[model samples]
Target: MTLFRQIYALLFVLFLLIVASIAYVQFTETQSFLSKQMESDINNASHSLGLMLVPALEAGDDVATETLVNVLFEGGYYQQITLTWLVDGKQQVWTNDIRVTGVPQWFIDLNLFKPITKENVITSGWLQLAKLEITAHPGFGYHEMWRIISNIIIVFSILFLIAILFARVGLGMILKPLNSLSEHAQKIAKRQFGPDMPTPKTTELKELVRAFNSMSAQLKQVFSSLDEEVSALRKKNLVDHVSNLPNRQYMVSRINGWLSEPSSGALMLIKMDWLEDVHSQYGYQIRDETIKLLAEQLHQQLDEISPSVIARIAAYEFAVLIEESERDLLTRYLQCLIRTTNKEISKAGCKPNERFNIGIAERLGQMTVTDILAQADNALQRSRQDNKVFHWFENSQQQLFSREDWRVKLTEAINDKQFQFRWQPVMQLENTEVSQRELFCQLSIQDNMLHAGQFMPFVEMLSLGAMLDRCLIETVAKHNLFERNLEPIAINLTFQSISDQDFHVWLKQFLQNHSTPERVCFEIPEASVYSDLLSCEKICHIIRECGAKFGIDHFGRQFGSMTYLQNLRPSYVKLDQSFAFIEENQHNSELCRALVNVAKGLDIEVIVTGIQEQEQLARFSELRLDAYQGFIAPPEEIKLG
Candidate 1:
């Protein structure tokens, strides 16, 4: 229970005890006092009656004496009244017994009142004519006692209730500061700090809160320094010194990472045809300047889209990799990029013959890292031979639809609401509980169904990835998935979609409209975040503020630098499934341990994904992952119940 409730309960119990004791004392004392007072009053009445009846006894008037005794007995205070006279030295008695009624038998027995009897001499002058004995009933005392006790109980009850209400109000006010401090502490655990915490009136609590705030500020400053150092180190290693774009190594690593996910897009290789001539005529200095200028312009154009990884690969060549929602738009964008580059070159006073040849290739299916680079390079060779500005190479062996054809199919599927959702439980390995479930969405066209691998790349290339994300959000929201299950729902957002500003705004608003924003999580790939850490950081901050959680999907794929993690401290990170297969190996096990330790330090949960085998599950259990998802949990259909 909360401290406020505990204190309130203790106070209530104390109040009840005090009220009961007071009621008991009051009831006993008032009843006893009333009994004594009634005895005294009845004794006085009997003595007076004996004196008044002297005339009747002296005259030997039996009828007058009987009438006088009957009158006193009818007064109701006395249960019985008796008159006695001695005649010819023998005792004579007159008695009236009127049974007590209307009072409860239990009350009468509990109150135990003994009758009072008094004797008096009825005299004419100085001689005693007869002795009169009077008996007084105390039944009326029992009735008065019950009334007094009942009134005392009612009055005490009201006082007790008022005391309890005031006590609760007072306690609540006092504990308000403690509640604020507790929330502040929780936020600090999440690496979030408040503007200013309210100071408590209690001296000890006030001091504690002050200490906590001071410690929190120091920690944030320390983390800030760490983040700066990590970012500088990452930039130094990954970026080219001349062009200030990511180097060949970073680009290749990123392409490899993207290949692992179920998405596709295009890669453009731009070669400066005039660079060799410029270097021979104007020397290396001017050639370098021209290349730098060209690099700057290309960076400006490609940076507009998300997941845009630009790099300087060779002396006369630059690579720009982009994942778009529509490949058709990418072609238009590339054509525009080529035209703009030529204009900049002409403005730099280069001859009309000074031109650029570009190679574009589609990224799809299970292609190796070398295959993608080779195909783009081959396209560049073909472009140079054909004397064309650009050439396209289909990287995958499987024949595919043209960009326009796929676009129509995607639009029709969306219009027909042909998306199907499947749920697989993310099990909490420590216990057997399902802590979360991941949503897998597929496009259904007539009798054929296609997974994300087939269509996501098309959606991303066409810039329709944002639409796909929105469709998922709306479907999940409408179903109230969180309400149907005891766990949160995890949905994947492509790098292109998260990079889209419109999608970012819509997601924020959607979370705000829902009562349980925390019950929904957005899964972003590790490489996608690394591709654009600055933008990802800003996006994550906004979404987290709206109470939505972020998880790094496909973690450890880069395996080179985790510096981005310092900036984007997500709620959890899912270890890529490939690690699970090699978990029994000592090297992989140690690597997994290192990752878990790093995650634990940042207070981020670690979950292993794609647990398909019993041995994999057992091996991961030994590794102590926070959760696991995939076939080991066995796929189950979601039910509203």
Candidate 2:
């Protein structure tokens, strides 16, 4: 038991001892005193009665003797009274039956009275009264003693109950520190520490709590630091540096994490694309400040029970993972975040008009982690088309998902030569049908056809996206002799696709080993550009120094400022689908005009993408677009032996 309980028990033992002592002492003294008083009263009554009767009996007045007997009996304090006269010096006794009167026979036996003491003096006629003896009524002391004892017991019982009541009330306060310590220990077991937990007050327990809290602090410090570095690695392709929220890359990473889960929870991926100017102007510092404030605001708005991870996956893109949280409440939470962040955006030099694209998904039963991530990623990608967050349906999970399946098929394809090299037919109008076309990626899984859209995006998110990408590139390079190709072949590089410090050095070494450096084209997604210009530029410079070509795919999607465009010096700028569709409104289309003009000024050729319709194809041709790719021209899968 606890110390308090032990103390309480000790006090209870002490109470019992005190009560027993008091009861014993009171009973003993009261019994002695009552016995003495009763004895004295009995003696007085016998003496008085004897004195009163002697005079009347000596006078030979029969009527007076009868009257004295009556008075002795009637005015008696004793239970029974009687008078007897000695004849011829013979002793005699007279008394009414005490048992027959109010006294019990058993009580009489229990308090059995011996012959009473007497002191006799001469009356007017001495009748030898000195020879008198008396006996008390049967139950005289029994009833009186029981009443005294019972009263003493009743009083002590009351005192005992009151003391127990007081003990319970006072015990809690005395044991407060112990209770606090118990709660603290429970929290420590769960690895949770914060201000919400109670702190103990007593010296010993307080010291324990302080020690425990310090340990927790150290653990958090270590783990949080580790998590931050992993976060930095995560940010290599996808993070808002200031808020540390996952950017597009982080969104893809979250999808990766979800896809990896045996049972994926709720996925709510939010894209904040309004902070481009903020990053471009203030150099990501203010953009980061804005995202940080927004993250705090968003976290405050989220469900207290809903666990979430926010990362800046791209410079202007933030992805939020709301795991197993309620949908409607999550919507409200997202709305709250949008309102709060946008409200503060202006003060942080980010606009109030910053838009958020949200994607919501839940894993279907019996699906691989990869498929779920694909579903979430596709949902996010599609949601980017709309301003509101979009919930996923069955179609959101594309056909032929999962890396293991893909890897297996890819290996078989690599062996069986099922892999086909398709040219995206990047035709410069100035040079039609040139022996060169930008090499587009195609995965022919026997009968099921998969494109980069099918699995590459999801693979880019996995820890080994870079590995898979490199493996694909190496396989293609190993099999294909790019040394003698007429058109330069473009190989895609993800922001994280090759962030391995060792891998970059390896790639530079590989460039020297295989294909001629001039024949290689390194294509990076413009939309997924790194936030750290210095790091990105340094990498780009390294790739350029390899004497290879560099181009940007999905260039206009980010709608970044022209300043970054000047820095990249890409060989090709792939126009976004929307830009390709809206080519007619040149004067009104500030976005497309800005992109095309900036690319022209930087000597970067523009490639309009997704031009499947004749109208779009016709329009882009009229606008002097550098190249075109889409269904308008039949796409023939290229076969490389």
Residue-wise C-alpha lDDT for candidate 1, range 1-641, written one tens digit per residue: 98988998898888788878987887778767877887777767777777877888778887887787777766647654544456666454545555456667888887467777676676778877776666666667777776777787788789878887888788888888888888888878877655667677798788888888888888767655554544454456556777777777667756765665576677889888677777887888987887778778776775664447678887778887776335666777786677667866786566643467888888766676688889999998898888888899854465367778888988877666568777888888777688888888877665677777778877866767778788777877777876776688889887777788888888878888888888888888887776777768877887799998888998865535665665688989998765654426554555666666566657888998767777778876666579887787765654322
Error of 1 at 159 (Å): 2.2
lDDT of 1: 0.74
How close to the true structure is residue 188 of candidate 2, measured as C-alpha lDDT? 49
Top of the candidates by lDDT: 1
lDDT of each: 0.74, 0.59
Quote model 2's TM-score: 0.41
Which parts of model 2 are misplaced by more than 4 Å? Answer: 1-419, 444-447, 481-484, 586-588, 621-624
- Residue range with the least summed lDDT across 10 consecutive positions in model 1: 225-234
